[model samples]
Target: MERRKGTIVNVGSITALAPGPWAGVYSASKAALHALSDSLRVELKSFGINVMTVAPGGTKSNLGNSSAAKYDQTHDWKYYKKYEEGLRARTEISQGPGSTPAEELAKKVVASVLKKNPPAWFAYGQFSAILSVLYYAPLWFRDYFYRLVMKC
Candidate 1:
């Protein structure tokens, strides 16, 4: 659709806004994607292309199971061994009951992208709002809350 102008939808993660424990690399990657999307929106505007950044929170899927299955929790850490359970739990945390259904999120994203004037940023899924709140919260508050909840 280069000639007709098209929308470029980039899927990111809500964790990019406020990274917590055991997911620093994942969060940083998503954050970089978000930043790239922002830049692309400006750079591609004259080309009749729309850039949208969709930051999903936690949607139900096999991600947790796959991660848990592939992860080797047997690794012996020198100092962070005490937090092993917490690290292991990170793989399954997004699969909790509160996660949004993957199909539901997909439908919403499709509808949004098809709109005549799609939003530049769309975020949905479980913990989406809470993470947004944490993004705006004070550093100390975020640190304490993440420590309490993640046990890291």
Candidate 2:
């Protein structure tokens, strides 16, 4: 905490606000961090700390693909296989569709931080758009959504 000065950006997922079945635990942990970020922003305000939480949508990264691969190898998705196509589509976002580049995301993040009066919360990308809307929808709607998109 002492090592850094100025702003502290905590990376969270859009799923932190609203979770899906495939990553319930991951979303919960991120939600915890999101709460912590909110708390610290208030606590450290007197000390001139600018805390911002970046709820990045699905950015292109190798980690998600690797996890999916591992799951394929070890997870007996006998049940989930029913939703195999949907699962593949959902997981592919983390691996990217080549539409929104990672470098572009980084640039936007950097630009946001560089602002003198930066937003306390910021989101970007296609999944961000989808998530922002989904975050407000009714629970049943969201459930139906997961079933539809995940094809469960």
Compare the candidates by lDDT and give the number of the best one.
1
Q: Over the stretch 1-152, how does candidate 1's per-residue lDDT look in tens digits?
A: 36858999999999999999989999999999999999999998888899999999998889788877655644556466688788777878889888889999999999999999889999999889999999999999999998998888
- Which residues of candidate 2, in runs, are more than 4 Å off? 1-5, 96-99
In model 1, the worst 10-residue window by lDDT is 70-79
Q: What overall lDDT goes with each candidate model?
A: 0.90, 0.80
* Model 2 local distance difference test score: 0.80
- Which parts of model 1 have CA positions greater than 4 angstroms off? 1-4, 77-79
Error of 2 at 19 (Å): 1.3
All candidates: TM-score: 0.92, 0.87
**How many backbone collisions does model 1 have?**
0
Steric overlap count per candidate: 0, 0
Pairs in clash, predicted candidate 2:
none
